[model samples]
Target: MSQADACLRLNGVTNKNITISNNVLYCGSQLSIKATNDLTGASVYNNAVNGSISATGIQSCGTFAISNNVFINATANNFYPAAGSPLINNGANPFYQALYDYNGMSRSLATPTVGAYEYSTTNNSGCATTDNFKCGSSTASVPQYSLIS
Candidate 1:
C-alpha cells in the first residue's frame, strides 16, 4: 500500500516498446514512474495513480502517448469512477489492440475506458445474456444489474 521510493521507479534502464496501462497503484508516499534516464519507448497510460509521475530524458519515446491517467486521493474506499466520470470512455485504443482489462473481460474497440477496469453495460459473468436471475428462480421478470465488479 505504501513505499519509501517510487512505486514504479524506472531508473537507468534502456528498454523499448514499454507500455504501462491498466494498473491500480495505491501509493501513500511515492511517485509512480520517475524514469531518470536511459528509459525509452515508454508509454504510461490508462492507470490510476495516487501520486506523481516524472519522466525525464526519455529519448526513444518521442511519440510516446501518456494519456488517460487518473490521479486522485487514495483515501476513497473504492477506485471506480463515479457516475459521469471523465475516466469513462476517455482512453484511446492502443495500437497494440489490448483485448482485455484487468478483470479479463472484453474491451470495446471504439471507446475504451481508463483505469484497470473497463465499465461494461452488462455483467461479464459469462451467464445468460438475457437476464442474470439465479438458477431455479420463480420470477423471470426481473433484470439483473448492469454493473460488473
Candidate 2:
C-alpha cells in the first residue's frame, strides 16, 4: 500500500511555549510524533526530517524542549530516529537567531527562516533588486525580510 507517508503523524503537537523551527519533514513511511498523549510545556526547534521516523518524535510526552533538530532516517541507517525518539535533546531553549522576532527587538537575520520566519538582514526596499522575496526556480539570493528584522 502506497499511502503511508503520514499514516499517523504529529509534529510539534503543541501544548504552548512551543517553537518548531526551520521546517522540512518528508516522511515516506511516516509515524512521526513529536508529542503524544499528555504534552506539557512544549518546544521543538530546527526541525528537519528526511524520511522514516517510525516512532518516538516525542511521544507519551512530558516537559519537552527538543533542540537543533535534524533527524534524517534515510531508511534507518540510524542517526537517532527511533525508540522514544522525540528526536532527543529534549530540554528546549537553544534556538538562537538572537531569540528571533526581530523588528520588535532580538535581531540576527540573513537567510534564517527555517521554522518561524527569521530571515532578514535588511533588504526589502520593496523587493526586486533581482527580487529577493523568493518564490520558485532560483540561482539563489532572493529572500530579504518579510518578518524578521
Candidate 3:
C-alpha cells in the first residue's frame, strides 16, 4: 500500500481545521495518514511514521505546520519505539497537542516525544495496562483478546 492507503484517511470538503499529530503509525507498506482537500488548514506533525505521509489540495487559510517528527519502524504487537530509536524525545512542540499519550499517560510539558507514546524506559507497552492503546499493526484489524482475571 502507498500513501493513498494510509492508516487514517481524511477527506475534507469544507473549511475545517485538520490536525494529524502525535501518532505512531506502523503502516507496513502503506503511509501514516493521507489528507485530501483540506480547504482551511492541515497540520501534520509530531508523528512517528513507519512509512510516509501524503497531502493533496491543501488551501492556504490557516497555518499548516509540520515539524519535529521521526520516521522509523516500531516494534510489533506493542508499537513502541525501539531502543535508541529516533522517535525518542524528538517531538514537535505543536501549537496544540494531546494532553495524554496512547496509554493515557500524562505528557511532559518540558520534554515531549514524537508519536502517540511518551518515552519511558520501563513502559509496559500498554498490552496489559490502560484503556487506550496504539499497540498493533496499521494494516491489520483489531484482534480479539480474552480478558483474564
Candidate with best TM-score: 3
Stretches of model 3 off by over 4 angstroms after superposition: 1-4, 38-40, 57-76, 128-149
Write out the backbone clash pairs for model 3. Answer: none
C-alpha lDDT values of all predictions: 0.53, 0.37, 0.55
Give me candidate 2's TM-score against the actual structure.
Answer: 0.23
RMSD (Å) of each candidate, 1 decimal: 10.5, 15.3, 8.0
Off by over 4 Å in 2: 1-19, 34-37, 45-95, 98-111, 115-149
Candidate 1 vs candidate 3: the lDDT winner is: 3
**Backbone-clash count (model 3):** 0
Model 1 weakest 10-residue run by lDDT:
126-135
Q: Summarize candidate 1's per-residue lDDT along 1-149 as a digit string, tens digits.
A: 22357767766656656776555555556676566675545665566556666766433322222323232222433344444655567766666656665446677777877665566642333222222232334453423325358
TM-score of each: 0.55, 0.23, 0.60
* Candidate 3 lDDT by residue in tens digits, 20-129: 56566656677655766543355655555556656564333212233222222333344455556676676666777766676666776666766666778535455532
Q: What are the clash counts of all predictions, listed in order?
A: 0, 10, 0
TM-score of 3: 0.60
